[model samples]
Target: MPTAQATTTTNITSTAIDQKTVPTTKDGLPTILNHWDCRSSQHPTPVIMIHGTFSRQLSQIDVTQMLHDRGYCVFGIDAGHNDNLYTLIKPEYYGTAHVDETTDQVNAFIEKVKRKTGAKKVDLIGHSQGGLIIRNRITRYGGKDVRIAMMLAGTHQGTTLMGASKIVEEAMPHLFPIIAAPL
Candidate 1:
């Protein structure tokens, strides 16, 4: 014989935990490099990271963790999202937006990060397109809050695509600008 009893379940919400958010992209998706609450007291200066074209902030997790391990506060933003529906499928490719829009997003993210950590200035590290955006922000938009900026293999001369682009350039000189310029 089994006895059945009606039981009531109550849902309780706790306010003890604090919730915080940092903008990582135009779509506001959560990224692997955003650590709003992990601001290090020992390392007062905060470091911000931006990924290269056709990449996401998550690709910079290694850098973020390295900085964090060294007691530095690190945050990141994945700007420049393609307006096409493909973004919905592969959101990781977030650096396809127009240059103006991309730079604007980076500037806004930098301002937001400065406000969050209460840091007047921040160190910026960018790769490829990210670096271009940083340069544009600093030179064109007056990077008033940038303490230092570093660009990794982001030369305007163009990327070799790990040597593949060089091959393409030699094979088809006419298609160099057509195929490589976009990258």
Candidate 2:
């Protein structure tokens, strides 16, 4: 049986599995059956990796390689190469918020991955704010249809710096140049 390990942050609890005695998969990939079910015989489902602010898809290549070796497909999405949260949220002119745009991009990526792999669901892994986007999709947008979600160093709740910046942005729209410069 897989033991459960839970981590709590910002009033939300997420789980991990610890299965010390189980045999690994035929490919020797560690099995956490409680966390994810193997569909190795099925055509591989693409894994999506989301990177943090100013980071690129290339940053996740090593991780993608590992997943590929384990019999999974991998892909990454770039979040417009913005330096800070403020700029990403308020682009030159925007119809969607930063998070909304990023999530839309992810949703589109999922469709593309599904079409390419001929799989029903894709796994999602996100780093930093990328993880927040994953959570938003899962919890708010009903993305439980996704196979699995892994978040590394994600900021699920609004950060202190974000709160401060929102206040400043509301108070001084004219200083957006200065406020957004170092963001």
Candidate 3:
């Protein structure tokens, strides 16, 4: 029998492993594009994944495998930046504002996925800013439909890296343009 861990939004259990596989996006990073809809379906809610700052959805290989083995569908958001402080402080597609935008996108995607999959709700797993983003979305934007949230090494408070960034943005307006290019 599997061991169960119950929470407000979902019930998680560790069951005997049947099969484990690596999922990937078009970019070749370990990614979750589909729910684990295998015959052994157990968990009803989908897993919405968020990666840490400068990290890609591909970074969640272990998590994806674990949830997949548990009969849960997993989805990952790339968050639009690489895992370098230089890249994070600089601008890419979403600029430094990617965190909030990514969170909102995650929420929207969750709702859409739920509607399509007929699942009642979703479970969120975030790492670092990935977690913070979810918290902000839930509290500020009213994520009542969210079933479960697990944050690993999450930043409940501000990060020193971000603080240093503020100083950089203030001290070097001229360099900010160059810095923002590779983000």
Candidate 4:
């Protein structure tokens, strides 16, 4: 004689009570890495950490941990396909992907984070090429989801290295094509 309405009410109450028992770390933070409790009163906006070219999320553990300690929900993305060559080259030159490609990746990452966390906006922290990626996302792409952006050693304008890249491009136009080829 139990009605469908009675069954649905029981399911909803059980689910809500189960969520309250979810375990957290010693600091009362969620044990899941790169996850934030969007329902938290203190931190509504999550932080999206973008690694510069040729780097992966693993390289940003130190900074991530620091932010977590300060009670910020932190997330990161390994933009582009540079994981294979990460160990071989210098970190600076490691992220050699075209800006446009990285920007696209950043845009997707921001959207994904926003969806997952149920957050309206996110703060950005970019390092080196990571910085440019976020900038392109915000300016070129429709990145209204971003709340604040901070870049470390980020290049707003193209790097000159005292015009080294320019000189090389001029001297051997064909070489530029070969060097710029996708890995």
Best by lDDT: 1
Return the candidate ranking by lDDT, descending. 1, 4, 3, 2
Tens digits of lDDT, candidate 1, 44-101: 7788887787787666655665566578877776688875555777765788787779
| Candidate 4 local lDDT, 1-183, one digit each (tens) | 875653433222212223235454554323434664544567678888888655655556566666665677887655665533433455432455678887887788788888888888989999877888888888886667778989999978767555766887899998986764433
lDDT of candidate 3 over 1-183, digit per residue (tens): 999997687666654423234555555546445643432257667788877765656556666777766677777656644345565464331213456676777677777767777777688898887788889779866867788888988887856566766687789978976775554
Q: Model 2: which ten-residue window has the lowest total lDDT?
A: 27-36
Q: Tell me the spans in candidate 3 whose CA falls farther than 4 Å from its real position.
A: 1-23, 29-32, 36-40, 80-96, 162-183
- Count of backbone collisions within predicted model 3: 7
lDDT of each: 0.73, 0.61, 0.67, 0.68
Off by over 4 Å in 1: 1-32, 84-89, 158-183
Better of 1 and 2 by TM-score: 1
Better candidate number, 1 or 3, judged by lDDT? 1
TM-score of predicted structure 3: 0.65
Number of the candidate with higher lDDT, 1 or 4: 1
TM-score of 1: 0.67
Model 4, residue pairs in steric clash: 52-130, 53-95, 54-95
Off by over 4 Å in 2: 1-43, 81-97, 159-177
